[model samples]
Target: MSVLVRRAALTVVAVAATVLVAITPAQAEPEGGTKPLRDALRAASQGYQDARTAIANAKKREGELSEEILASQARVADLSAAVGRLAAAQYRGGSSAQLQALLSSGSPESFLDTAATVRYLSERDGAQVTALKAAQATLARQRKDLDAAILEQENQLKELRKRQDEALKALRSAGGGDPTLGFGDLPANATPAPRNPDGSFPSEGCSVKDPTTSGCLSPRTLHAYNETKKANFDHYVSCYRSAEDGGEHPRGKACDWSSAAKGFGGMAVGAEKDYGNKLAAWYIANADRLGVLYVIWFRQIWMPGTGWRSYFGSGDPSSEHTNHVHLSMR
Candidate 1:
């Protein structure tokens, strides 16, 4: 072969190797064959996270209301004291004090002055009484609001428990025998995804372009992908695909991080297994901030409420997720 042609061939091979390390080849079916279980996991995970967020918000509101009630009570006490003083003055003086003062007045101007003073005192007492009533009413309303907030927190806790149970049951029904003490010594924190004003993740569509494939991914998924890369787990990843089986793939809210550099192969072992473990643990640690619904890796799955449950996939590497870590986003 010519020297130029040989160099060109070498360059093409290098490029091919790089591409293989960056993405998996397109396949007809999704890796795992647990569509029903995945769907159940998604629903349960989302509900559980929602319940948690609601409970947090309710607690914050309860604190605010409690503080307001305390302030209102103080105001009511001060006003009540002022009103009591006015009542005591009226009781001691009676109308006789005013009449005596009017009788002693030597001129019409002095009589007018006394009358004006009495009128001013009467109006001030009435205003103080009105303020006391208003303060009491405000305190009552604040107490009611605090009660409602407490009730909401209780309801959300119940819902969170319910969702946790559902997730556990779904896994068990699909042959999840017991929880696994998943990977340890997780990597450091990832950059958080954008959130709404209230600290909750905002709704996202399949908006951003997928870097691995000529498809699209939600902004949250892309953020996860970028963070994973930043964590030095830059293996082959595939995020978006049109699957008839119905999962986050079609919605651009999922990504599969291959354990092997060459692509999805046999079960990851040794260093590759360690790589997958660290990646999975990182996702779990940052699940709340990343808007992650669930993560499946090496025959185990992690959801929000449930820590890590056994996951039984079809009898293959892809189905078992033994060679990749699958992430589903909310």
Candidate 2:
């Protein structure tokens, strides 16, 4: 009887195992019975990777273009200096005494030679001035083109980030456990505010000096910068207003701050000082609350250190801010 019971128990265990194997749960399928979303997300990731490559290429191109622009500018400056010297010489020759010295030669051939030399110098001076002007114009156009390209690449990067964020969100939503998974844990109500009438923000009041106009600022860009500043400030205030809240604060401008530097009028020392100080003060005021370990802004391109520190009478502090949180609004 004991042997019979042992065999019966083994048979029952095998039958249960077979039933469990035969009735396995179905694998989960994503929504809509289509795999297009997953495919799209993969494509978007690839596109983001491509965008990073494009950004690197754009930066290299910008550097090359900037070097060319500088070299061209230096050539123009040299030509300008040469022209100035020649003009001074011509002016000195205009005096009656100098003219007499040139003309009152021992022989006609000597006088002709002196006259020919003066004429040659004048002709060369004129040619140099013309060449300098042409070079300046060409380099100015090239710089403008490079600036536009940099802006374009930056915008493309922003778009890529947006798409990547969306892709991540879609993947998380499809994966199903937490709705917020893969969607960066943003505040529940983190929607950006609409632009006010006149396309300005109430919190922003700074004006961007105009490069084109003599003393006036660019109203349009000034307004835009102010709005961006306000928006960034608002984001920061919203995120880190309290220690209990675990949100990220704004660390940089929404768009490229370097672009606004162009509208800072001429290369006046005081204007740069004032703008730099204001930015620094703003950072300092919210530094602790915002958890901003470091903030860097490269006027020309992205670099290792705090561009602000260099501006603030400090040695290069680029490497020091590496451990701090990195936030790039642009």
The list of candidate 1 runs beyond 4 A from truth reads 1-23, 26-33
- Decoy 1 TM-score against native: 0.89
lDDT of 1 at 41: 80
Clashing pairs for predicted structure model 2, backbone only: 210-217, 305-318
For candidate 2, write residues 47-71 as lDDT tens digits.
5544655666678778888988889
Model 2 scores a TM of 0.41
List lDDT for all candidates, in order: 0.84, 0.41
Write candidate 1's Cα lDDT for 144-192 as tens digits: 9999999999999999999999888878888883889988766458898
User: For model 1, how many clashes?
Assistant: 0
Position 305, candidate 2: lDDT: 17
Best by TM-score: 1
Q: Pick the candidate with the highest lDDT.
A: 1
